[model samples]
Target: MAAILSGDRLRFLLGRFKDRLWVKPLVVCLLSIVAAFIAKLVDGTTLAQHVPEIAAESVETLLSIMAGSMLVIATFSVASMVSAYASAASTATPRSFTLVVGDDASQNALSTFVGAFIFSVVALVAVKNNYFEAAGLFILFVLTVCVFGMVIFTFVRWVDRIARLGRMGSTIEKVEKAATAALKRRRNAPTLRGVKLTSEPHGRTVVATSVGYVQHIDIAAIQAWAEENDVRVIVAALPGTFAAPGRALAYISNLSREQGLEQKQEDFDDTRVVRSFHIGPDRLFDDDPRFGLVVLSEIAGRALSPAVNDPGTAIGVIGTLLRLLVLWGEPAVEQDEQAPSYDRVEVPEISVRDMFDDAFTAIARDGAGMVEVAVRLQKALHALALVGDPALRAAAEYHGRLALKRAKAALAMEEDYTAVRDVAMFSETGSQRNY
Candidate 1:
């Protein structure tokens, strides 16, 4: 069955039409006028003898011809012009609208009229001595213009949609990159200038070190020395961190400060420190079930829990841990098993951090129904910004985490109504849930 288009749907279809591109009816109108003129001249000279009565009264005949011909041409012209407007209105979107300067609409309208005049004049000239016969050709000219317009408009939409897809794809890729992070071993470390190795184990032993590397570097000497000395080091430079050649990382022992530097260094600039680390088999210190749990407990106790935070505190802490491990120059997990073995996918855009954000958001605000909160939580990205947009996103995510942050607080305080009011205010599902 052929589906019937509704008024609104039809309008939508028409709006995308290119008005200037479809000025066919106007062209036909101009040709028709030319054809009519030719017909009048031929009829006077050739058919004048046969149609004496019609030709005798020249002023009357001229007036009648003007009125009848004008009425027919004007009706067709109005239909053609109106159709252009209708097509444009249907397809144009609010977001796609860029207010063009100058007078495009008026100019297009004028051009349409000009095209019409050309078609009308040409048609009348072609059918000499027979104005009524020329009128049939005029109608055919109008049909041809409309058909051409429809074909052109149909192709334009497909081209536009393809262009839009390309644009949206690029934007999404950038967003994806900004979201996922690097947990990688370093070589030609770029962003991180060098590493600062502090106090090692008491027994003069060093385990393998980890870090990220952005560029290429000569590490034969560094590797040979570490192997012979029985020391393990890590270089944790990110993928984009710039590293210059011949810059050696500094190994500083007995580092004295307000807080003792025991384990590994942090993410910092390139010019300050120097050192390269080692890579070993990936393994955790212990199979402690309590690793994430302990962090969550601390968070809950300090009001820093992700359940009530925008960027959930728990997820942020985990992300930081991942980042630190990366900086330590460790080999990250494989992105895909089938992917080349040369590299591991440390933080794909859709990451564990993004996952945790969703989980925390669900726990913070119990709003969604008929959906698995945990499944949704797994979609969070691994990318994090400590001081800037990352922090803001984290905060928003925390607020989205659970429904009972304040309630938990109020319940702890023995205030029921205040908790109720708080929950009500923040009960709605957060926008970040989609993220």
Candidate 2:
């Protein structure tokens, strides 16, 4: 019962709810229903008694006009959003399509249109039935004006957002924002609020029963279970990992035969441990930095494709990746001095080396023939090497050499090859002269 209502579980559920396109629109529809009822209530109150009568003809006309126009507007907006999502999928990474579809501005705009339409339709029906009193009519008129104002404001913002919604630059910005958020969360809880897992598990390993990407982990649930069992739970997988039935999801340690069968049976619940983690078909940006990095790399790959041949977009993505890496390299902010949240739960820290590979490996391969991209990549690595730690710098140097080798093989011109090699050598040696 405690694990079921854990904060981690709640947050994971809430995050999933917010990603749906229908959630906001459905909420708006419910709110509209409530508002309609409130308007009727206000009509009977003394506060609305002083208001002048709104003619039946006038109320009918206003409601009819808004109802007709709002439906048309809502349909058009939905079509535009669909088109934008399709374009984003075709041009940028398909993984980014979810973010584009769930954009707050677009969702809010669509919700407003749907809500206004519902309000207008209900108002029209009530007015036609002569159900509204003079005060109710007056209240409805005021709300109509307010809805008009909101619709206009939302339309303006929607137009502006649609213009850049799925473009390369906008997509890069969204990925960077997501990556930064994931990095910050990891920085705070590098081991997922548990002890760091450093080696292979010698204890009983709990394998997954299904195959899917791990989306969210319920650390609170694990902590509670661990405390009850008096054992350390070492997580073998993190968010974005592909869990197979035979693969270890986590490992349990410090078990003994001293406890009776009933106690042992009650303590080790593999199903509960599996339930603590949410598995899904696709990865989410909330808890997975690797997904963001992979999406960014996808954008670079798409830009470097033969049909597109947009090196500039790839360069921009590289710069954004560097910014994300630099942020990840910085130490986490000071945390509270209270007892560690999940002392019995153990998780592994993210690898900077893996991060570097995710950010650059594919881009280097695809953009090898483009001298401009090669030189820029080399220069970027050199800059990163100056600021990054030993492991980070080592990864950067390794990629720098690989990129240079590919550049030499791809570039036919001696000058272009020399230019990229010189940059790569400087990056590798930190020397003034070329190798």
Candidate 3:
């Protein structure tokens, strides 16, 4: 019953394309041309006195059939495009869109996927019905549906990752600078101390601290210090470069204290391997985990954008994580050991991994390290958190690294050969043992 309703919806969406301009005619014309060619190519050209009559009848029949099929295909093509637009819009979060989509991006990709599916399905159904007697036609229908769906999927990905051409001329510097500035600010924290501080982009203030203790100066003067003295480095993979937190954008080299006083923004046409989009489709973030650095920058970008500073810390974080997971593939992080005694106060009875787990049974049954091991992992985060201080700025970093390290260790443990270890492939998947 549910399947029927879904089909109806799909058909209805595809039907909408029939009324579109140029779709009906184009489809009918293409099909007509092909059908005419087939009519000409077939063995039965004419049948004597009966040949003329037979040829006339055959051409008329073929042309009619071709027109009908063309009409259906035209309608389907339009529907697929519409569905793709919707699907692309749907999956996309409301990014600063400035960074990826646009600030007001919508999640409408589902409709597009459905549209494409519906379009392809309609074409298949037409083939199944009209070409039931022709084996070649049946094969063609199946191939068409598969190819169309794959194309739609690829189109959606492209749209999601890169900006449309209309906005090609626009600059992608806001988030670009944000990532670098944020990273440099954190990496060169010691220098930022003497860097003068001022209320600039709102919520966050720019601090003009020195690379080291410097001569006292006015806030206005310090503002230009970074620029005049040339204090900053050109962070590779600039802001919006899809970097993990703690990922080195660029390294700073020898610079006089005066040069370190001011960070200047230099514009250069970089023709190197610069990725405009960070979809993480490829294993892009396999090494660096410094993407967390961009979330704050994204927030700052939104808070200061031309379209009402809509800070997107969560969006940036999720985007970074999703990209990281997809590019490098996520290890079973939840399986890692937690720090020792970090959460031991109330969970003395449980392992850190188990305590964190929703179900205690699963954790204990797994081959993760002892609860004591997880406790130590948790303790490591806590200790590092304290040392790092400024909980907001540093705690998350320490904790994130701790979590990743522990998860990685746990996965390694699972792979290790041991007496109690479980390493068997499941019969159904031919992949690995479920347990």
What is the C-alpha lDDT profile of model 3 across 15-119, one tens digit per residue? 335324445444544553343223223333332223222222332343344334534643554454444344333332222232332221112232233333344
Worst 10 residues of 2 by lDDT: 426-435
Poorly placed runs, candidate 2 (over 4 Å): 255-267, 425-435
Off by over 4 Å in 1: 1-162, 165-170, 177-222, 228-231, 234-435
Query: In angstroms, what RMSD does candidate 3 have relative to the true structure?
Result: 21.3
Question: Which ranges in model 3 have alpha carbons more than 4 Å from their true place?
Answer: 1-56, 87-435
TM-scores for candidates 1 onward, in order? 0.21, 0.94, 0.23
Give Cα distance to truth, residue 359, candidate 1, Å. 10
User: What overall lDDT goes with each candidate model?
Assistant: 0.32, 0.84, 0.31
